[model samples]
Target: MVVGAGLAGVRSVEALRAHGFGGAITLIGEEPHRPYDRPPLSKAVLLGEIDSTVVDSDLGALAVDHRPGVAAKGLRAGVLETTEGELAYDALVIATGASPIRLRGEGPQHVLRTIDDALGLRALLRQGRRVAVVGAGWIGAEVATAARRAGCEVTVVEAAECPLAAALGPVGAHTAPWYERAGIDLRTGAMVASVDLGGLTLVDGSTVEADVVVTGVGVRPSVDWLAGSGIELDDGVVTDEHLRTALPGVVAVGDCAAWWSRRYGRRLRVEHWDTALNSPEVAAATLLGGPGEGAVYDPVPYFWSEQFGHMVQYAGHHAGARLVMRGDPVGTRWSACWVTDGGTLAAVLAVNLPRDLMQGRRLIEGGQHLDVDRLADPAVALRDC
Candidate 1:
């Protein structure tokens, strides 16, 4: 039985049967809707250019029992006790996913995490009201872009001195003009002291009036249902290199899973689409209790965002790294590579440059000792090396 039917769970179901695990598989998900693509929910779906149903996985084609709208409340050893009832399993995967952070206030505000939230926000956006978005994270920024496209005046309030300070750091945040040109009223270091019916009250006692507000502070893993479970928890379900949890016969993947990354030598929790797609491949192979083949999930963590017609691509993590920039931040056609103090590439972020992201992903995966001169040359093709 699968505990969640998001991208990871759906992928696991197809992969298990393909790998000759012929046992009866029951896929359980809390959301009533079929397993759908969440990445587009913030982009095309929000802009009303794509339907949510378009991304749902065709589980019936794979001949698997998919139980949507069923919430799993508890797990005991190899069995799962859901809000509906209980089911036994030889192997269980936890793909409960993450939930958006709701800011505490007099807020009847909307957040764009779930499909339901996206739909509700889309309806509210049709009124063409002014939107005040709190937090300048990727989700907040993307939602702001959607709001702008919907003809809503967007204002972003962030506590950090620069947008994306926590995730992308100063160099990346310097690309703020991209949002400014898109007509986003970005207010940095603006502490939200209180929220009222009229709008939000800043720490300086100024009010930003808005018809609607969205708080995209961040997301917390949906591991609250497994709080009683004996599995190790460190912000998310802690798993090994093989994606096995502290408990036997149970594995965790996707946004809810935090595993030790061999490449970065750190316990990383990635709430990314590709991580959800590929990480579970490791967990399924490890379930047999045998020496796995070509094991170890050391793939570079990657993510992308489309806002204001620019495809912003990021590969790898940039924690404690130097920004090796070779781009005109305003021109929006260059790439920036995050390098370690010793000069090894930690990550690469590109705007409107897919080739750099593609080849940089290979360099990261291969752990190649990059030629510094070649990488610095803007004219040299990455494939030429």
Candidate 2:
């Protein structure tokens, strides 16, 4: 039984069938619609450049019993309780995904977690509308982009001094000027004290009149349904290297699952689409191959975003790694690499430089040693290093 109708759940079903699993499969989804992509919701969908249909895909031939618009209430032992009925599964895969964190005292506060959210926000983003976006992370940045495109006066309110502080560190703040260049009011170190229909009130006793307010603080794993399931839960569902939970015959994957990565020697829970698409194959292999030969769920985490006229791509992890610049951050195209003291590549970020990310991802995944000088020199080919 697969619980979730999102990318991870659908991909898990496809992987299982491709691996020749002839057993009966049941896919349960809380959403009424079929599985669809989510990345475009913040980009093309919000800008009205494309509709939600762009992310829709047909999963009719998967030969699985797909139940849409049904909610899973709980899980205990081998029985799964849901809005439909209780289901007994020999093996269960949890792929419930994550939920976006919302703001308090919300009057017109919104989050871009579903198709309805994008559509609702898009409808309110008429020309001359004042849009206040709280949080300067990926979602906030993208929403600001779409709002500006719709001719709305956009103001981004960020609690941190820099954007993407938690993810990209100091380098992230460098992109802040792009907001000004695009005529957006980017307010840093600003805390939102209250949000009402009239507008937003900052901690500094200032008010920004806004027709619509969007919050993009962050998201938490959707694991509350498994509270009494006896499966370990930390930041996410704790799983072994094979994506198996503490409970036997139960496994977790995608955003809600944190598996120990043997390559990095740490537990990681990635909420990106790449993790959702890539991890399911390994999970399916492990589910069918059993304990003796199950494949390990270790992958190079990757993500990309389109904002402020720049295409950004990042791979691997940067925690505890030293930063190495490949090109000038002030330029239109540049790349940054994170190297460990032990000489192995840790992570890479490319801004408008696709080749750097394409090659740097391999080096990081392969744990390749870098000649710091060659990597710093943009003229040198990344493949040669």
For this target, which candidate reaches the highest lDDT against the unseen true structure? 2
What TM-score would each prediction reach against the true structure?
A: 0.95, 0.97
Candidate 1's clash total is 0
Tell me the tens digit of each residue's lDDT in model 1 across 230-325: 999889999888888999889898999999898889999999999889877777777754445446777799999887778889998888877666
Q: lDDT at 73 for candidate 2?
A: 90
Model 2 RMSD vs true structure: 1.5
Candidate 1 TM-score versus the reference: 0.95
Which pairs of residues clash in candidate 2, taking residues 3 or more apart in a chain or in different chains? none
RMSD of each: 1.8, 1.5
Cα shift from native, residue 92, model 1 (Å): 0.6
| Candidate 1 ranges with C-alpha deviation above 4 Å | 54-56, 289-294, 371-374, 383-385
lDDT score, residue 146, model 2?
Answer: 94
Report residue 18 deviation for candidate 2 (angstroms). 0.6
Candidate 2: tens digits of C-alpha lDDT, residues 61-150: 778898989888999989999998899998888999999987767577988998888888999999999999999999999999999999
Stretches of candidate 2 above 4 Å error? 53-58, 290-292
Candidates' lDDT values, in order?
0.82, 0.89
